[model samples]
Target: MTPSIAGACGTRLIAQVLIAATVFSGTAARAQESVQTFPVAPSYPAAMPASPLGASVSALLDHARTTNPAFAAQRAETAAARERIESAGALPDPNFQVELMDFTNTMRGGGTTLLPGQVGETRYRIIQPLPGWGKRELQSRAAGAKADQAAAGLDAAWLDLATEIKNAWLRYYTADREAALARESLALLGGLEEAMLARYRQGLAPQQAVLRAQRELTSQRLAQVGIEQRRRGAAAALNGLLARAPDAPLATPADPAALPAALELPALVARARARNPALTADERGIEAARLERERTWADRYPDFSMGLTNNRPRGESQSWDLMFEVMIPLQQSARRAREREAEHMLAAADARRDATGSRLAGEIGAAYANFTSGQETQRLIRSTLLPQARATRDATRAAFETGRADFDAVLEAERQLVDTRMALLQAEVESRMALFELEKLVGDAL
Candidate 1:
């Protein structure tokens, strides 16, 4: 080969090597960058420091009231709504007028003895409109209804805020339990993998056993990944509900030892009907609409005014006259139509309120029933199924060590144990969530 060709070929080879190296370095860096940094899963906090149910409920409600923007906005709006009453009851301020007289001429030769006088009048007058046909009273009632609706609206806001907080708390509880279970499963799988590796190396186990163990370990690792993700998500949601940063640490009381015992459906329905804030708000809206229709009726009549006026001519004494002004508009087709529309709106609001109350009653009944059923299921699992599965696992392990139970039995037992544990955890989680939902639907007993 010529020296020049050789040099070119050498440079090409160097370029290829550089390109390959660059590609590999880029891939490695991307892989590292794609990896996530997860927060250390902190252990569950201690049980609630407070014991009185009322106090605990109040604390939670207070936290939500302050943290929830919806509730805060409603409070401010209700305070603003009070101004509407004062505004509605007030009459228009009286109008004032001022006038000045300039030059004036009196005809002297055009008449006989009577003076043919011209009055260049300057007059000052005040007009105050008197509300006719109980308009003021009707307006005051409407304003009062509006204020009532706003107050009820604030209650609804607080209710929703409280429900959101409770839901978030339950989610955090679920995350904690699931994460704990995942960690425990990981540890157990690790032990099994070690045992499988030892047996395989001793020639007592097939290579496939080691492979299977490795696969199981990897599966659990993946499960842990998902569990951690949920944990972080739950934490972030709770923090946001409490008006903190998504990553902010939270201190939550541990879940209760057991779910509440079942209650009669009738009682639950009653509670919901009495306390559901959304239902209350709807009722208030209906009342406000009714009052609005009444006020519209009063608007059909016009107001009246009475005033005194003074008239003076240039270089002459002032004369005063009392005047009364009455405004009677022609038949108001528009006002009548508006009154009918208000009536229909009031009817619609009333119907809507009734529908909401009915739905709330049904929901509370269903939630209570499901919650109790779940509680029973969890109790049964904890008392019987889980313990039996655990005993089976222990027995299988003992037999394997003694050379009686085969590898298949050991694996089967392990599977059953895992399934039982998972089922129990799910049951517990469901029961807890159901109870939380029930309480949210019906205000806390306390």
Candidate 2:
């Protein structure tokens, strides 16, 4: 009886252990399934941040100055030229030299040696070169003028880039606007087609009306393809300017820019003469050339150098000597050649300045004329032509629905409305682009 009790208790303990093992194994499997072994992928922002620059003109210009390689190159060029201002006036590096005199005498008794400390006499010298009176100042002034010229060149590059950015922005915005218009027109046509179908069912419209409606729908869809292409192309051009990939996505444009106010031709021309980057660059070039000529002429004078020499002689005390030297302007032919070069460069610089000014005036005049005329046309269309077309379209559609007007009349009115809208869009874009060009030439917005 005791042996039976022992066997039964052992069996119960073994069964309990097996049940616990099963529960633990099941939990381990679930825990393994819950855990992840692979690394999570990183996420990146879109190519064009939403509201980056907020489409502000200043923000855009600043961003371009920071990112565009060509613009950055211009900035670097300006900086390098400006650096010459400091270096041009600096005194020439002082000369230093050492001489070991009769060192072999010390080696006469001892094994041959060439040590400075064992020499019989040693000499050390330092010389400092100084330019003639007014020479260094002239050189510094010349460098300053050159730096100004480089700065003007950088401004010119910026103006050109700004115009391109503005034009591209306008193109992108116009494409979107045109697409919206097309979509609206498509929806309106869809409603009109439905109305036409109902009329046909009631025996109020002809069968061809339904076919014409379908055909118009197809044509509208085809037009959207071109609009989409325009948007993509504009986006690509903009991305290139922003130093991004051609296919990078861009956020939608914000509010449109307001129309700029008008200015008189004389005023614009005067402003262009004063602030235009090309003209300023040319003027600075003339100044630089003139200063360079003066600086070169100053080079015809002699330069002076002061030197200190230390001397020691065998069986003698050390002595210090001060010496002065003058550089003679002996290369007469070379000086004459350089002078002639400077004169020619000055002449060329003056001529370029004149030509640049004349060209600037003409460009400003032409842009002003175009911008003014375009502005007037845009205003007229917006105030009069567009409203008239819209009214005509609404009236014709209503009349056709009541059987008072023909289907041809309704189609003609819709076509006229579309054409008028397109004309308005084209006018606005062209005028704004003209304004941008004008501003570029003037070097500031009017």
**What are the lDDT scores of the predictions, listed in order?**
0.64, 0.74
Model 2 clashing residue pairs (backbone): none
Root-mean-square deviation of every model: 14.6, 21.7
* lDDT tens digits by residue: candidate 2, 122-213: 78889999899999899999999999999999888888887887777778777877786687667656666666665555555678987898
CA error at residue 350 for candidate 2, angstroms: 1.2
State model 1's lDDT: 0.64
Ten contiguous residues with the weakest lDDT in model 1: 36-45
Residue 82: error of model 2 in Å?
A: 2.2
Q: Model 1 segments beyond 4 Å from truth?
A: 1-61, 99-120, 308-314, 319-321
In each prediction, how many residue pairs overlap at the backbone (N, C-alpha, C within less than 3 A)? 0, 0
